[model samples]
Target: MPTEVLHRLSTLSLTSVKQLGRLPRLSSSLPALPAPRPTLAASEVPTLFREPHILSGYRPAGQPWSSYLLSTFQWHNESMNVWTHLLAAPLLLLRCWSLLEGAGGPWRLLGDVAALPLVLYVVSALTYLACSVAAHLLQSRSELTHYSVFFLDYVGVAVYQYGCALGHYFYGSEPRWRDDILGGLMGAVYLPSAALLAWMSCACCCFAKAHYRRPYPPRRKVVQLIPTGLAYVLDISPVAHRLLVAGDWQRDDDGALGFHAAQVVFFMMAAMFFSYPFPECCLPGHCDIIGHAHQLFHFFLALCTVCQLEALFRDFLARRAAILDVHGGELVVGAGVSFFVLVLCCLATAVWMRRTVQKRLKDQQA
Candidate 1:
């Protein structure tokens, strides 16, 4: 194969950091400098800092952290990506707070362990958005920061998936589905498997990030996407089962079923954007600063979250009694502990991968 073709093919995937065949020899002495201008065209920035089909508005790598944060005020490629979640983060927080206040203020949540799932959902939502903001906003500071920031972002994604599963299992599931589906595997495998899948998703995504270099190959998407898709399927299975089973799909106490139904639709729509570089790939530079597919992904995802929060809150109000009556101890403590365990495991994995990234950087310097 030609050298360029061989290098491109090598980037399809890698088994480990050491397998980064002919690693891209990134600059090792980029100063912590300020932005030279508002933004650079794609040709000016490092390939690693550029986006697919995005031919302009690239932030220069190695700028001080504040430049990136301040860039939120400037129109750049990532401006919408940052604000989409940054703006939605506050709205989601207020909505959850309002629900808690109406229920008798924040202390009310503390009074009942049964509220842990809801609490987890809120935390997971906010955490993921915050992680995304940090990643997109500051990732340009350096290649190492890029990997580290996105490793954290990947953790947030997995954490959110697990939170969604907890909410679905606790609030959205029908009793019959719980007892009947897969011979009640949810009773035994749901939480543990969700946790495991969450960890796996995080690890696999980090691997893909490390395995592939920019400009990333087409197959790189599939490598990272498979694990994420698996995690989402597992995370949403409880609700999927409930929605599929006719016996309980008709039951609409508190009208949560409608909200749950809407969430499913929105999520599926969002998946399209998540999996493809659409609209943007079709018209590259035109969508650089706005109307980007990733921005669309965030928008649709936020819609999904809106529907999910409403449905889960409604269930908490109307279905909590029945759910509690059946499963007296929801293992609220164990569930909380499980989430933290996932957090620790993901952090450890991120840290380990980061060490590998640090080594790669050193090798490039060599």
Candidate 2:
């Protein structure tokens, strides 16, 4: 009876070990059963989204259309920046057309002789508008798109300035000594303006490109050529002395281009007040809305335009005085004073902009 009892006890121990081995299989099956397909955590959504429903399982990723739509609908910083200058285009066109209509006869047929300048202005404006639009809409899509468009926009502004200066050199003419003086003043105003425009284009293009694109590398050597090209083009003033005297070029004033190019560098230092701190000082959110560095720069440019116009008018008086009789000397003096003030103001603006930029940088660092 004792032997039978011991054998039965051993059989029960074997059964217990078998059940323990099976217990692991049951536990393993629990994980294999797919532990409740994890629902997305709240943290999984983008930080920009205030609500999950707004996200609706959408992420921008590589989607071009999504970025385009967001540019319009989203309350982004660039929204107003794109539109303000866009509205300026039609207004510019209307003004140009009206000026042409009023000129009459040969001037009307030539489309206001000023039309070439206007065309350059309109084209630059339109290109800038397109760039702003693209930057806002497509910049988010990829790094490559952003840098390219930004570079192009800078180029457009330079091209606009070049065209404006050329126009002044061509048209601000009169047949008197005072007219010659006035023409010289007008030429001074525009010549510097053109150079500054070119420098800005080249500087911004080289800087922005080098800094912005990292994942996608552009050929540095090719980009270096852009500034070189800008220098050559801007320095090469469209004016020839012979063109003014005989209505054509006998020997192009290649030297004049380099001379004017130097003047542009000086003006750029003065205008640096406007763009140096850039969006940080003016362009940021405030510039994006209404009063920014670009707008201020445009305002200064318009002032230059007015100064040139006054000089042109004085030249006309001087020329007419040579033909008829008018006080040309006094008019020339007044125009000179006005031009001096404009230059001083531009310098002041540059200084102010520099201080403002420094403050912002300090704040940012802090």
Candidate 3:
């Protein structure tokens, strides 16, 4: 009787374990996602959804949000635009995950305050990539959604430009250049004005987008790119100075120079396509579904960002000892303060821009 009783209890224990294992499977069997929506031509969607020379393969506006999410897997005018940054976001995260947990291991990172800027840079890069992904994916839902998401996208760009300024200024810069004048933005407060430029550029872009019609004219293009270009020039100052004026290119001790040069080249190439539409402008509807300039633009921009991160990471490591000596514990305070200020400013700017977008959208509807 004792043996039988023990045997029954053992069987019940085994059964309970098996049931617990099965529970996970049951829990994981979630409802299936929506299937991809049927795509439309440029003519099918309203003019607001259309892009010049992109004659086909637009997702119909007002799809359930799920359909837009599912469209990530399907082909459309925005597929590469969605994927280039979507895939890159995870890749960037994967590359930076170890660093976030502490670059010199968790313990060493506690003392290495200089790693702060790199951490901020990583977070900013991820923010921009995620925003770009959201913008490309959901921008087709409605006029309001289109404006709203893209406004957020511009905010992301502003954040990222400030981040790039941080990484380049601290890690990649020549110290002599750091002392130069720009509204006494010396030390960690470097480029506060540049941040304003970026913020104002977002406002400029929003205004252009609101007022301009599809197939934006040269005037609209100028309004969009002029301030943005100026911001780019200022934000890129450190790297540009290092590569051009400081002659950092002549030194190849860490392979950072190569990566830096590659980033510049890739970014300029991508920016050209972003501005002009290039061969797509020449080919038009023939290139709509498969090979479009915007698609190539997305690809090259991803590559540029990857190269930028690579170079900046290399520089951070190579200059760590010097950074620690020159900056001391100020590394934590300086980087933290600057990033905090930038976030506050960006959030404020985005909120103001959102209100403007809402007003414009309401006016359009009315």
Best by lDDT: 1
The positional error of residue 114 in candidate 2, measured at the CA in angstroms, is 7.7
lDDT (Cα, tens digit) per residue for candidate 1, span 323-343? 667655647668888999999
lDDT of every model, 2 decimals: 0.78, 0.39, 0.74
TM-score of 1: 0.88
TM-score of each: 0.88, 0.41, 0.83
- Most TM-score-accurate candidate: 1
Compared with the true structure, what per-residue lDDT tens digits does model 3 show for residues 116-235? 778777888888899999999999888888988888888788788878877887788777667664543555455576667867787787778777887678898888888888887777
- In candidate 1, stretches whose alpha carbon ends up further than 4 angstroms from where it belongs are 1-34, 247-249
Model 3 clash tally?
0
lDDT of 2 by residue, 1-366 (tens): 124323533453354346434544553444221113211222442332212122121224244554444434333333334444444444445544554454442254343222333344345445545554554455434334444455545555455445444333433332332245445464345456545545555454535443433332345434544554454344333322322353432332222222222233433532553334354443333333334444444433333332232222222222332421332444333433433343344334434444544465468579
Q: Each candidate's root-mean-square deviation in Å?
A: 12.1, 29.5, 12.8
Please rank every candidate by lDDT, starting with the best.
1, 3, 2
lDDT of candidate model 2 versus the reference: 0.39
